[model samples]
Target: MDVEYFDYDNYTADIDSNLTTEGTLNLYSASSSSTYALVAVNIIICVLGLAGNSLVIWICGWKMKTTVITIWYISLAISNFLFCALLPFEVVYMITSHWPFGEGLCKLASSALFLNMHSSVFLLVLISTDRCIMVLFPVWSHNHRKVGKAFGAVILMWVLSAFLTVPSLMYRKTTVHGSVIQCHTDYGVRHKAVVLTRFICGFLIPILMIVFCCSVLAIKLRSLTHKSTKPYKIMAALILSFFACWVPYHTFVLLEIDFKKHNLEVIKTGLKVGATLAAANSFLSPVLYVFIGNDFKKTLRRSLSSRIEDALAEDIRTALR
Candidate 1:
C-alpha cells in the first residue's frame, strides 16, 4: 500500500531544492480537498475495523471453543486488528504531510501494513486449503487435526509474513523533505523488483491457490449426500471479499511501477481510493460472518455476540456427514 504522500511530481523537486520557507508554505497551502476526504474514509475504516475485529477476537478467542476453524479466524482478526491500530499514525501523516513519529515507528508502521497483507492472505489460503483437505480426507483430518497443530500453522504463517515484510522495513524511512518529515519507501533502482515481488508472492500466488482450493471444495461438496451450501457460501464470501478489496490496490501499485508512462493525477487518485478500499477489508470478515453465518434471520434474533459465536461454531465435518 502506497502511503498517500504529497504530489510526487513536485515532491521530488521540492526535496531536491531543499524546500525554502516559501515553498514549504506553498506546499502546505496546496493541500487538496480530496486528500481530506480520503483521510475521513480512512478514519471511518479504522474505527469500524477496530470494533469489528476486536469483537471477533473476543468471541473467537475467549467465548468459542478452540477448534481449528476458530484458530484461523482468531489469527486473521488479530492481524487486521494490529493493522487498524496503526492507522492513526498514517492518518496523521496524511493530514499534516509530516510524520511526527520517529524513523523507528515509520519503518514499523509501513512494515506492519505489509505484514497484515501477507498474514491475512496466508491465513485465507490456509483456511481454504484446510477445508479442501478436510473435505477430501475426512478420516485423516479427524484423526490428525488438532488445536496445537492449528496454533503451529498460525505461528508459521506470521513468521513467514514477517520475513516477507523485510523489504518494507529496509526501504521505509523518515526523510526531512524541507519542513515536512516524510515517511516513504526508497527502493532506489529496485522499486520495480520489490513491487513485482510483492504482487507475485503476496497477491498472485496466494490468490491462485485459494481459487484452486475453492474449486476443489466446490466440486467435492456437490457429490456429497447432504447438500448444505452454507460452508460454500461462507468460503465464497471470504474469497470474493478478499479479491474485491485487494485487486484495486494491487492494480494501482502495478500501475505506479510505470507511473512515468501514465497520467500521474489519475494514478494518484486511484491509489488513494484503492488504499481506502484495502483498509476497509479489515472489518469485512466479521460483517460476512454475521450476515452469512447460519440462518441469517434466526441469528438476527439472538444477541450479536451469540450470532458471531454461531458463525464460528460451524463445523465443516458436520457438513460432510
Candidate 2:
C-alpha cells in the first residue's frame, strides 16, 4: 500500500486536466491530517523494525551456531530489515505526494515491498512445514534436515520471491501529473491477473499450508499426553500473528482489483491502514521472540540477544527430540 504500489493511472489524467488552485487546496486540506499520521507511523515502524530486526540478524546470524532454525530466523530477519530500510522513501512519498527518486528506484522499492511479502510468507510456510515434520517424524527430521538443506530452501525462497515480484518491476512507473511526479503501478490490462497472483501466491496458498501444518502439529501434540505444549504454543502464536497482520492488507488489495464496487475513499483508507498493520509486522517478530521466547521473569533478567537464543534453543531441542 505504499504510494509506489497504488494504481493511479485512472486519476492522473483527470488531475492533469482539471487543476484549479481551489481544488488542489481542498484536496490537500482534506488529506493532510491522515497523510501526516501515516508518515509518523511509518517512521516509527521503520526505526523500530530496523533496530529489532538488526538485533535478530546479529544474534541469529553470528552469535549462535549455524543450524536449520537459525537459517530460517536469519533469512526472515533479513527480509524484514531490507523492507524497513526502504520504508523512508515511502514516508517521503506519502508526505510530498511526489517521487524524486526516478523510475528505477520506484520499481526497486515497489518490487522490494512485494519481495518481502512473498519471502516472509514463504518462509513462514517453510517454518511451519519444518515444525510439522519434526513433530510427526522426529527421527527422519533429525537425520535428514541439515543446515545445507535449509540453505537450499532459503535460496529457493528468495528466487521464487524475486520471480513473483517481476510484475512490480514491470508495471511500476513514474508519471508527471502537473508539477508533481507520482510513482505507481500501471498494470494496464493485466491488473487483475497481477493482483490475483499476489493474493494467491503471497497470501492464500501459503496461509493454508501454514494452517494445515499447525493443525497437524496441534493434533499430534494433543495425543501425546506427556509432551510439553510450549513448542505448539509458540508456533501457534507465530501463525496467528502472521494471519492477523497480513489478512487486512491482502483483503484491501483484492478489493482494489474491483474498487469500483466499494466506496473509493473507504478503499483508499483501508489500503493505508492495512499497509500500516503490515509495516508493524516487520518489528513484531523480534518483540514476540523477546517476550514469548521465555517466561516473563526470565525474559526480564536475560540480555535481549540471549533471550532470543534461549527461546529457540529450548523449543528447537524439544521438537527435534
Candidate 3:
C-alpha cells in the first residue's frame, strides 16, 4: 500500500514528534464511535474467554496426566489467562476513548497483551503439527513427543516470541494529545524488523503450520477405511473447526494490510469482524481442544466418571476412619 501522512499538531508536541492520532491527524478516517463499540465487544469476549479458559486450566491442571496435548493446553490456558488480565486496561482505554494507562503501562500493557496474544497462534500451530505427527507416524510420536520435550518447545516459543516482539517492548509508549492519551506502537519507518515481526510471528508462520498439518491429517483420514472413519470424523471436525475459526482472523490480517495499502472502507469492516473472530479463538479452543487428539480426549473421558468418584469415595472412607 502507498503510504499517506497527515499533520497531527493537536496530538503532536515536542514529545510526540513521531506519534500520530487517527482523528487528530485525520489518519484514514476511522470513526472513534465505532472503535468504542468494538472495544465493548472485545471486553465481553475477553471476559467469556477468561472464564472458559480458566475452567480448562482447572480441569486439565490437577486432574489430567502429563501428555503432549495436556502440555499444549497448559501453555494455551496460561497465555489466555494473562491475555484476560490485560483486558481491563484495554477496556478502560476503549470505554473512555483514550489511553489512560500512562506511558509505562503503554509498554507493559502492549507487551503483555501481544506477547501472549500472538504467542497463542504459534503454540496452537505447534499442537496441530504435533498431533499430525502422532497420527501419521505413531512410533515416532511415541518416541519423541513426551511432556518434557513439549515443555522445552513451549519455552522456545516464548523466547522466540519475545525476540519477535522486542520492537513493541522498546518503542511502545503513550501519546498524550489535548487531554487524551492512547497506547500505540511507535515505529518510525515501519522497518523490516517491525513488518517482518508482524508478518512472521503474527500471521505467516502459524497459518502455514496449521494449513499444512490439517492438510496432512485430512489425507491420512482419506486413506483410512469405514471402520476407522468415526473417530477420524470427530478429529477431522475438530481440526477443520480450528481452521475455519482462524480463517476469518487470518483473512482479516491480509485484508487489513490490503486496506492499509489502498485505504478501502469496505475491507475495514471485514478486518474488524475478522479481528473479533480471532479474539474468540481463545474461547473456541477450550471447547474444541477438549477432544482433538488421542491423549486429551482419552484422559478427559477417563477422568469424567471415575476419578471424581474415586476421590469422593476416598474422602468418605477417610471420614469414616
Model 1: runs farther than 4 Å from truth? 1-30, 293-301, 315-321
Residue range 194-220, candidate 1, lDDT tens digits = 778888999999999998998998898
Where is model 2 more than 4 Å wrong at Cα?
Answer: 1-30, 293-298
Which has the greatest TM-score? Answer: 2
Off by over 4 Å in 3: 1-31, 191-193, 225-264, 267-271, 289-321
lDDT of 2 by residue, 9-57 (tens): 3322234332332112112222557877777788998999999999989
The residue-by-residue lDDT of candidate 3 on 120-195, one tens digit each, is 7678678677757867887877677677888899999888777766776787666667896656554554533454
CA-lDDT, candidates in order: 0.76, 0.76, 0.57
| Better candidate number, 1 or 2, judged by TM-score | 2
TM-score for candidate 3, residues paired by index:
0.71
lDDT at position 193, candidate 3: 44
Which pairs of residues have clashing backbones in candidate 1? none
TM-score of 2: 0.89
Candidate 1, after superposition: displacement of residue 292 in Å? 1.5
Candidate 2: give the clashing pairs: none
